[model samples]
Target: MGSEGAAADRLLSWDRVSLVIGLLLLIVGHYQGLFVAPAEAMMGDVGRILYVHVPTAWACMLVYTACFVFAGLALWSGKGKWDAAMEASAEVGVLYNALLLIQGSLWARPTWGVFWTWDPRLTTSAIVLVLFVGVLVLRRVITEPERRLNLGSIAAVLAYAGVPIVYFSVKWWRTLHQPFSSPATVSDSFITPLRLAAFGMIFLGIGLIGLRWRALRREVERELSAPALPAALPTLELGQRGPGGAA
Candidate 1:
């Protein structure tokens, strides 16, 4: 095989390895979180959702931040690769963000007795979701390549402005959401699973993003290399002589 094929094989190998490691971590982490880790003194078993929820929320924001950086690079350098990275990261960010909201709601229903609330943290998170959703929708409607890239990058940057707000909203306002605490606050037993889940989700998210970026890059390459549609054959004027001078 050629160098390109070898490179593709290497990337695919890494993607598979990363996915396997991430899956294993998730399995071990979830098992520990559910069975081994001691329940919270105040929240009891309901708090177990923290293992998944916290990590997912972290991954969601992390990907969005990366997406924003990619967008900035794309806008500055006008590089299609950066745009591909931005698109892939945006997609992963949206997926994790949606999951974050779902996991929060699931935990909330039992803890707060409500599935939805108008709290600041929750509201900002919803905005984060809607903003990215709008970006994806905007991407679909724009047909021009350069225009789409420029506009989508701008949208990603704007959407990222909400991320820090989401993180700090709990602290900045009186809300139903709990403020994030340091590692010292968590028990040793709980720490293992939380850390495992956090790293696992990060690896999984990055791996998935890599795979998506590769796929998009291929699509862009195909689009660029594909032959343009042949110009429509000039229509013969009605009532005019044909090419052979036959009407």
Candidate 2:
């Protein structure tokens, strides 16, 4: 084992720590938010939807941002390993976004009297999902590793550009959906576990991303190192040029 191997091991350790801490906080916060928080005056039982909606939304954005970060790294350094990380994070991010849409719609039906509406937040969120789904699909169509990476990077940046719009659409444009309110939203009798839940989701997203990233990194490494198949593997040969591998 060399210094590079030692460094990879340390990163692996960091990922494990993040995953454990994140799951612990998520469970603890979910319990408090769902069971312990007092019912609201206006929304009644439906108000408890806050715990689910807010956290999932937070995680969705967090994961997308991470995916974008990894995408940028892949494009900047021209490394297939970072491309795998980007793809992995985007898969999980899209899942979180889908959950956000479903949960938001469920909450909407009770409060708004309809299962679906064209609120800016909801509409933008739907667009976000479709955009990244395109990214995943595009990844499959390209057989060449380098071309796939470049296409994926472009998709990531374009899709991520919509994230801020989705998050702030409610704020920027007057909308039926309530503006987001976390610790900063209230000051009376409602600041404890809800705040914890928000932070909990943050950590949880971080941990999940780390775990997926490391796993995907290994997968890309294997693909790079694997012996050529007898006949099935496509001859999309990637080569090192100008220097040893990528800088």
Candidate 3:
């Protein structure tokens, strides 16, 4: 019990640390992007959105990738922690993916003069998001833990296949969205803030994932440890003999 208490304390401390660091990074990153970075000559201030937008997009994929890996691990080892991690990653990944689409739309309206298009990158991203959302729905509908875990893990892996497609669609197809593969293409001022925001988002995403996983783990533990309810007493039927033939 003492050891368990110590372990829990350590986890709590780590969670707080992660939350603080993640918040700090995001705050600083936003500051740098808004104040420190120079405005682009072409897009001007609108380009600043890239700092948050691109990072959110990157973090979405990163979290999903982690989800895929966690699902695989859970399935392979049949470990509960891995399932918790997978769930955490998937939920957070979906959130970031949603934000990515919104940010992309916002960026697109100003740059492309339209809120949306059937571009390959955008289409593939939407598909990925939908599939992951299906994973979440599947989890809720399924009641059995093992069954839910198995199905969700499989779905997570299947959905992850779309992530690479989304990533490569820009390169594979002629899309309106510009490929940002080369640092040389972006200005130094933009690069610094972009990197900062990227790190900030990465840290924040990871921290959230950790905290969520731990919370889920605790819930599972409590469910497992909880004593079962006492069995209900059987009622005597009308005109039926009770136990030992008593009325």
Taking all chains together, each candidate's TM-score versus the true structure is 0.83, 0.79, 0.82
* Clashes, model 1: 0
- Compared with the true structure, model 1 gives a TM-score of 0.83
Q: Who wins the lDDT comparison?
A: 1
List pairs with backbone clashes in candidate 2. Answer: none
**Per-residue lDDT for 1-247 in model 2, tens only?**
2675576678457667776776777677778767877877789878877877777887788788889998999899877678888988898888888988999889889988988877777777888899999999998898777788898889899889877766576545745665557667665545666666667767767776666776777766666454765765444535653333431
Tell me the TM-score of model 2. Answer: 0.79
> What's the lDDT for all of these models?
0.81, 0.77, 0.79
Count residue pairs with overlapping backbones in model 3: 0
Provide the clashing-pair count of each candidate structure.
0, 0, 0
Q: Which lDDT tens digits does candidate 1 get at residues 10-48?
A: 745666677777888888999999999989887899999
Off by over 4 Å in 3: 1-6, 9-12, 166-174, 221-247
Order the candidate numbers by lDDT, best to worst.
Answer: 1, 3, 2
Best by TM-score: 1
